[model samples]
Target: MLKRLLCLILLCAALPAAAWDNRGHRLTGELAHDRLQASDPAAVQAIVAIMARHPDKARFDRNLAGLTGEARTRRLFGLMARWPDDVRDTPADRPDWHYALKIVHGWTALDWYTAGKAEAQWAANLATARNAAAPPAQRAVALCWLLHIGGDMHQPLHRGHRLDGSWLKSDRAGTIAWVRRGPGLPPMELHQLWDKVFDPTGVDGGDENGDVTRLHAAFAPRAAAMVPDGGFVQWRDESEILARDSAYTGPALRATKAPAEAPPMTAAYMTMLRTIAERRVIAAGVRMGAALQGLR
Candidate 1:
């Protein structure tokens, strides 16, 4: 029993700290695609053209074999959102670019550099996506990052991580903080719980049509109202606040060293988590659309 528990702990610890899974990223991208069609038809065409020049366009073509017309383009855009994650372990892999894990310390400006390079990467990628002097293929990659990082920025855990008390250092954005979702269920990482809060089954409700349409219809109005005027740094700061106030609440923060002894998330906590996850997904979509609309 001791050996099994230790193995499980090591397995959980090694799980990748991805901000949002494939479903979340795809939903955000699809919603943004729909928004662009409704608000900026020309930009939609421009973006599609740009994405055509992506270095992995052939792979995209193979995956989108039967898809054509608007369906093909929309799905293509969604694939771009997942490209950054898909390229992991390859030459293009940039693990640190996915998050900006700001330590919740009272450190001075001199120590701010200790945080991940996500914010700086965001600025650089946005500039690349907008720079006409750059190659079309390069802009396509940057555009993909914009779609992806926008979703990451809204994930509370991706912005700030706990370091005090039970965590002598950090939870690595909850990737190592094991917890139970319910009685008799196996222990799972806290970050994975939040990553799948919107789609707990990990299959998007097994709906053939997917969750983008349903989520967009349900949260479009709220997302529109909440969309920022524009400021990536400000958006990240909002997530940091949510991490401290919402994500680190209840039994989650009371993590102990034992995986088998991990606490179960309460019904109320799950309710709150789903609500925040829904808002973040829709907001990320609308914001991505708004950012793309600026393309000349």
Candidate 2:
């Protein structure tokens, strides 16, 4: 049992970093799917048809096996949101497209930023998705990327990477700022901590459907207020503000300067992180829904 558990942790650590874990990504997709269904059922139909033309349609089919109708559609949308992370290091992977790192040092925003092509890639994919003349399979791939990247942009860490005095280099969205959840716990990347905040006990091990339903209901009241009225640029900027003001506060900032070992995150800090993370996830879902509704 001990050996098996160790292996699981190692395997998890080997996985590439993403804006959110599978459960959070699924929730974002599910919410967007629901929004699209309510406002434009025809758009949902169109999206489903386009997804059927994906080059990896067989892979999708395998995952959707034994499921049908609404359940299948909802799960497929969630899969769409997670597909990019699933295909990392493949020819289709665009690692840089996952983040637009507005660098910071301490409390000050730096003038220089990394060449994160999230904005450009998102626009390109959107154009392809909307272009009637584009090949069906190509458009299908574009649509998948659109779903994934839309969620990526709303993750605050994906929007900024800090430059700590200790390193004088970007933390690469907190990938290196290892932190402990409690005393004697194994060190985990700060990025990983935030990524799994929504599904801490493991998405598969928890009540994912219930959590999704709960999150959607909780945020539904704020849906009208959370829409990205100013567009993707505005969404990116909002995440940057949160990353600076919320994510990089106090204990998280201190972890950056720790010499070697991962520092412990305060209990109060963890509580606050959870609140910010939940809000960000809902905002991402709402904005993604709006983007899909705009699809021609």
Instruction: Give the backbone clash total of model 2.
Output: 0
Candidate 1 error regions (>4 Å) = 1-17, 105-114, 202-209, 220-228
lDDT value, candidate 1, whole model: 0.75
What lDDT does model 2 reach?
0.74
lDDT of each: 0.75, 0.74
lDDT (Cα, tens digit) per residue for candidate 1, span 171-191: 767888888776677777888
Task: Find the 10 residues in a row with the least total lDDT in model 2.
Answer: 7-16
List all candidate RMSDs to the true structure: 5.9, 7.9
* Best-matching candidate per lDDT: 1
Clashing pairs in 2: none
